[model samples]
Target: MTDSSRPTRIKVIRKSMKASPDQTESLLWGDCLFCTDAAMTDYDWVLVYDEFPRTPVGTIRNETEPLLCPPDQTILITVEPPSIKIYSRAYTSQFGTVLTTHSIRDLPHPGHTLGRGCLEWLYIKPMQEILDQKEFPKTKMLSTICSAKQHTHTMHKKRYDLTRYLADRLPELDWFGHGIREIENKTVAMDDYKYHLCVENHLEPHHWTEKLSDAFVAMTLPFYAGDPLATECFPQESFIPIPLDNPQKALEIIRKAMEDGEYEKRLPAIREARRLVLEKYNMFAQTAAVIHNHRETGTIRPGAMLKGRHVLRKNPLHALRELTDTLAYKIRSRGRRGTGTGA
Candidate 1:
């Protein structure tokens, strides 16, 4: 007998193959009690972060292993872009429901019923703390923080090339990130600039990362690329679109926006977007909303397991792919270290 009035206890299991730095318990669990282990029987709910199955053994003690979650007690969230095949698997039977930008087969994101596009997870402060802050003192006009890493993905290469072109063309544009320079924090680095260039690695519809949102939180208008459907997720006027195919045009647009005082004009919209980021779009807020809904309705069901796929086991093809990718990544790492640049 669980008390419906009490905050639900949630166990957030990381299922993404990529290793991430540890996040605070409050950021990870929101209003819910943070359950450290799925083995803990006292936990009220389990939230699988990106239910991808391609993971090596003994990595974080096989955290990607599938869980036997009851329909009402499990939730899956996919923050990875659809471009990455590893995170694209539909673990229909593994989790109760999913929270993602794109539709996972016929699975409706439980958070969408509350409000759409609240799937993003980031290191964010409380909403009121963000809203109460005075505007950042801008000392620079336009700048960008981009990595120079080259990858097999066409979009990644394009980003690298575009960054080089922009750096060469705009002498005034301050560039940061790996290869060019490193910053302690992106939001802090962006705060001093009136506008920041932020481009997603992949340009898929409804797929956006912290790139644009980070800029908004820094109160910097973004000269953005990728995610044609960005307006569907954020306030339309919060960012200015720069086409990926045209660096020259992007440069011109950046110049014109700064000249026209676009940052100042869009300041209100940017502030609104930041509020949305902290309040609704963040992982904590979204998880809390889902817990609230489940507490009220008590009708959500766990996903149906596919016969052989429901259990976590080694997939031969996936293993071979992982091996190849690992080798490639090691080679890339060595090369990056040798050159002191991702280029």
Candidate 2:
């Protein structure tokens, strides 16, 4: 039996995900040590952050490998949205169980789709330090950060277009991200804003990303879009939803929220949501809870496993279709960039 007082050692398989402090042994949850070192052998459990296609196993970016541990001792978690089938479908042959996070407000479970997890896992330790304070003075009224990404997904295209529209009109808004004026960290800019324009790349049930979480951590109310199911996981009053279809109406809401002191009115709910993000929704905290549950139960049955080699496996026709779509998107994106109208 494992000792009750000792901190559990969890070997995290990054699978070419972003680098973080945990990649080299970091302490968290008061009793958990997470490390991404592939050579480490003395670990109680194996957790795989399965973000595939975009971040496939091995250096070549197309191959995959089996879980380091036996099925029972392994846990696979994917944070991508269901729209990205390539990411969701990658590395399926390696593990029997995968925990999906989109549906759960408190704990992760096996589900049909993968939604977003803490995309800010790389900076959670420092984010927690910033949130530890009780008050943050809002020097600015609103801001937003969006990357100039060209995606084949329709929702992604819409989001990028909307971001361009907002940036042009909202002069008071401090807009910055990839391909814009680069900021070293999101928290620094977020800390000074009263409200943040937090929109998702796609709109699906229970889908949300770090855009919302960053606002909450910095105690800035989010003028949020996407994720109709967000209220189920967070306080309803925590965010003001705007419709992407109507740019004028979205602007009106932002203007009214700022003029009417919406941040002050919603401060209570924002605090609650911030606590949820820090204590319950952060990736490290969620992983720690899973470890605790596994220790208490002393057993975790394997879920589903695919047979044969862990390679990029898909129907030839479907792959061809996707390839064609990507080429079309790239061509259109080039034209938009030439016209100075693309994100």
Top TM-score model: 2
Tens-place lDDT per residue, model 1, 1-343, is 4675766677666543333333324334445775444233355677666543345422233334333334566766666543343322334344545666553422233333322444543325564566688857898887787777777543667787778898898877889888778876665557679988887776656667777777777888988897777897678999999977788998889888988999889988898887887677766677777776664434333443321222343666645654554354445444332121122
Assess the local accuracy of residue 313 in candidate 1 as a C-alpha lDDT between 0 and 100. Answer: 33
- Alpha-carbon runs more than 4 Å astray in model 1: 15-24, 27-41, 51-61, 64-69, 88-92, 103-132, 295-343
- For each candidate, the alpha-carbon lDDT, in order, equals 0.62, 0.63
| Shift in Å, residue 65, candidate 1 | 7.0
Q: lDDT winner among the candidates?
A: 2
Instruction: Give Cα distance to truth, residue 341, candidate 1, Å.
Output: 24
Model 2 vs. true fold: TM: 0.75
